[model samples]
Target: MAEPFHIGFLLFPNLTQLDFTGPLQVLARLPGAKLHLVAKTKGPVETDCGPFLLADTDFNDCPKLDMLCVPGGFGIDQAMQDADTIAFVKRQAEGARYVTSVCTGAFILGAAGLLKGKRATTHWAWHSHLARVGAEPVKARVVRDGNLFTGGGVTAGIDFALTITAEIAGESVARAIQLGIEYDPAPPFDSGAPDRAQPETLEICERRYAGRVADFEAALAAALG
Candidate 1:
């Protein structure tokens, strides 16, 4: 039998659940693919909403993956600051055939210095932060630079994964998966991106995440030292 294509996803406390799970659900359905939920340590990791998820494998035990996925959330601030986590991402990305991130997970990739001088995108709220991390931020739902794929916000993970499937498996497989999921997204709200959102709404989101920004800034400073 052919070797399975292994995909590793990083799990950290306070991570945005959709950022990883949405993509995982799609990718797991692919034939002959192995998925590994990797964490710095073995055990349960909590989401931002207080749900705990059990990881399938610890980082140390996992082999080099065909793809490495980093999901973004409030927890990413902590992960970015963690030397161990950053080092793990850096090492895995170096060997993985594909390196990818969802939403603020791009920040974690940036923290690992994988995005320097690269064109990328992240949650609209963090576009400036992406620039701060030495990446050229693009205004798009998904940005692909070489083998690195990045998506914007939580829901964008689905799009990124579908795109990856199209690239790796085939367009027919990606279309089948899309049709299986019935993924015809029609957001009730008009504001998904900053440019589409009202200035006031954008301000509110910025203010709401101000503390996280500060925390991430400090963490980046320490990590860069």
Candidate 2:
């Protein structure tokens, strides 16, 4: 039998727990696949909600992976500004067969110089910022530009994983995983994306995250220096 495909998930402090966990659950159910939660250090990492998650391995100890997944949250802005994290991401992505990001994880990838001239996506609120980092921003739920796949906001990670599984393992496997997860989704509100949202709603979201956005811009500028 062939050896199982190895997948590494980059974990950092303040990461969106669901962004990583949701896809980890789906991928773990697949046959003959190994998953590793990798962090800068092998210890418990805290999420934005204050919960702690134990990582399986440190970056130095992580084995070569067939796929690398980066999940995002407010913490990503910090990670993007981190020189050590950016260097690690660039190195790992260069070695991994496929590199992917969830939500604002694209910011980290962009910081690593992985998204240059590549089409990518991120949370709707941060799409323009993505373009500023030299990535051609696409407003899709999942944008697969070659070996680099990126998704929109938090929930889009699930869809991105399914799409990638279909490409890698096959449509049957993807469909089975989707079914196993009971993937049907119905939002009470119709405004999932900025284009679909009411002007007032978009305005509110922009205002709410304005300070965060400002901080992110400052961080990106510093990281790029």
Candidate 3:
């Protein structure tokens, strides 16, 4: 009998719910996929939005995954600095057919030493920091280098998942999923990217990230040490 295609998303406290759910919604439809929401424990994990996601499998019980995704959120500041979490990601990457992350989740992959010497990307706000983890940062919705894949920002996780799905199953399958989910994207604003955002909008975003960036840098330093 063919082994089920195991797919996992690493869950941690305070992850942006969309980062995890957006991708899961797409990947869950993959042919014969067996999905797992893995975390440190079976207890519920609190997302940044105040909602909680229950883990079906703990790190210790997770089966070897064919594909693994780590989603980003403020929780990354904590997860990147976590030794057990880093070790778990590292160990899983050794056997995963594809190792991937979304947004700042790239930092966790980097902390696991998975992004070193790889070309990758993350949320634009944190794109430059990819270099700190020894990665050549690329700006794109999805960047794939060898078996490592990464998505940009939060909503990009869905795009990233579709890309991987196409690779694994086929373009036809991916197209069907996209149509099924109506993955058409038409945002009300053209200011999603820094290049497109107005000067004032960019300034506001910068101000908002000022403190968060500092905290992220400190966590990155400690994790990479």
Query: Model 1, range 194-224, lDDT digits (tens) per residue?
Result: 7788989889999998888788777767766
For 72-95, candidate 3 gives per-residue lDDT tens digits of 999999998888898899999999
> What shift in Å separates residue 204 of candidate 3 from its native position after superposition?
0.9
| lDDT of every model, 2 decimals | 0.89, 0.89, 0.95
Candidates 2 and 3 compared by TM-score, better number? 3
Off by over 4 Å in 2: none
How do the predictions measure up, each by TM-score? 0.95, 0.96, 0.98
Give the candidate number with the greatest TM-score: 3
- Model 1, CA-based lDDT: 0.89
Q: Rank the candidates by TM-score, best first.
A: 3, 2, 1
Best by lDDT: 3
lDDT of 3: 0.95
Question: Between candidates 2 and 3, which one is better according to lDDT?
Answer: 3
- Between which residue pairs do clashes occur in model 1? 72-105
